[model samples]
Target: MRKHKIAVVPGDGVGPEVIAAGLEVLQAVAAADGGFAVESESFDWGSDRYRRLGRMMPEDGVETLRGFDAIYFGAVGDPEIPDHITLWELRLAICQGLDQYANVRPTRLLPGMQGPLRPELGEQIDWVIVRENSEGEYAGVGGRVHAGLPLETGIDVAVFTREGVARICRFACELARSRPRKRLTVVTKSNAQRHGMVFWDAVCREVLADFPDLDVDFKLVDAMAARMVTHPGDIDTVVATNLHADVLSDLASALTGSLGNGATANINPNAGVPSMFEPIHGSAFDITGKGIANPVGAFWTGAMMLEHLGEDAAAERLMKAVERVTENGPRTPDMGGQAGSADVTKAVLAAL
Candidate 1:
């Protein structure tokens, strides 16, 4: 049996609660199968810890995380802390330092999960949004030229490299091949930013030549958004630059269900380094301790982590159990049900 060590960072607010649910699911699946052993260690590195320790995580945090098989992360944000300080110190630090460059978010609606989308647009939405994690718009290369001055100026440069663009495009293509639909769409604004967008388009064209069997297409970000609203079924796999991907994935998540139920996986496939998994939603400080937060997103994220770690059996079982739970319709308030976080989590465990 393989024994995998998992580092659990039960971040701020409902992070702790949902992580508890995910851990419960892990233990339940392990107990039933007896095929693997998972040893987990908890870390206190979130907004609350930040408030007391004056740092999001320890100085040697990446070193500690490197020792584990994978890091099961919860959301990180606080009303009291500045957004930059909170995000940079915690989530972004792990992503950049660990080089988890493939932000793979599968946007699929759970059976009972409902959102504010038009009723008719509900049933026909399922797709994966693959974002180039490392470079491009999120590179953080540029900064403010002046602060607290009459004429304050700030600039953020989008950095795109051949390696970065090619890798994510390939990842998206591979994902599309696995799905029922074998179509891959590359999103960019080559009409505007000639250099950067053209470079992205060139890489997409180069990558597509390698995957000759797959159907390929490209669309501008603005027109793609309109198409997503009208004909989401036309899209099978979407690969885009960081900033464009950021907006489109959120839209994709909304189309499936509430933002609270969206899941994300940040991966570095070359090294043996494990991926980081979390929900798309931020810390809900307003409803933190009220027990009203949804745990579906974090639980499904655990399913994705299990799949990535080569625990295919466990991952499939957990996902089926979640689908069963969702199909039964014991949803939380965010999805239009009155159940609390623990209630929905317990229901999922029961189904498992």
Candidate 2:
């Protein structure tokens, strides 16, 4: 049997709850499928760790996670802490340090979850948003206030590099080719951020030329947002920059239902750095211990991790089970049901 070592970081807020449920689902799948198993090592690494140690993960944190086959991450965010501090300290640290530069966030409507698409458009809404993870507007090239007291100004430079843009676009194109529809939509704001976005569009054009068979198109960020609401079926795949993709993907997920149904994978396939997979939603601290937080995002993210580990069959099975449970209409409070996260998790497990 092949054993895969997975680094598990159950992050903060309801992250641990969802992680527990997701691990349970993964275990169930392993029991049902032979010849493969997962060994997960829990890591106490997040905001709380930062508060105590006065830093995010240890300096050796990236190296510590290097040996794992993959990392199963729960959401990371706490109202009590400064968002950027924790984000850069942990999430962004692992990403840039480990060279996990391509973030693939998939937005698909679950069975009972409603979408902006009409009934005639399609039954299942599946789309992937490929984000340039390392550098873009998120590159952190800016200055804060107090530097010029008279001006009292702050500056944020939206940086974009050819290497970063080209790699992520190529990844998106490759992914599009494998999907049912060979289509890729490049989203940008060349109309506004001329230099940076124009560079991104040029990179997309260059990459699209390599994949001649794929149908490629570009949309301004604003139009893309509107179309996503009114014409989602028109899009099959989307690739965008860090900040733009971040906003659009969250909007896409919300269009399908709540933001809790999306999962993302931060990958650096060449480095052997274990990819980090997690739900796209933030930590819902309000529902922290209420048991009302949705675990669909976590479980679905686990499925993505399964596929990344080369267990596509198990991943598909888990997804089908999720679809079944949702179709049966046993939804969590966010989805307009009384069932808690545990109830939905068990229903999914039973279906599996």
**Each prediction's TM-score versus the true structure:** 0.96, 0.96
Off by over 4 Å in 2: 116-124, 145-148
lDDT of 2 at 202: 88
User: What lDDT tens digits, residue by residue, belong to model 1 across residues 1-352?
Assistant: 8887899998987888888888988888887779887789999998888879999999999888998989899889888899889888988899999898889888876786665567566666787889988889889898886699988988988999998899989888898888887888899999999999999999889989988888889999999999888886787788888889889989888887677788999988866686799988878877888888888888889888888888999988988888887778677777777888888888888888
For 1-352, candidate 2 gives per-residue lDDT tens digits of 8888999988888888889899999989887887689899998888889889888678898899999999998878888789998799888988888889888988777777775567554354578888889988899899888775887888889878888888889899999999989999999889988798888898889888999989988999999988887777889889988888889888878877777778889999785679999988787888989998888898889899999989999999999998898889578887878999889988988998
- CA RMSD for every model? 1.4, 1.6
Against the unseen true structure, what C-alpha lDDT does each candidate score?
0.86, 0.86
- The clash tally of candidate 2 reads 0
Off by over 4 Å in 1: 118-120
Candidate 2: C-alpha lDDT: 0.86
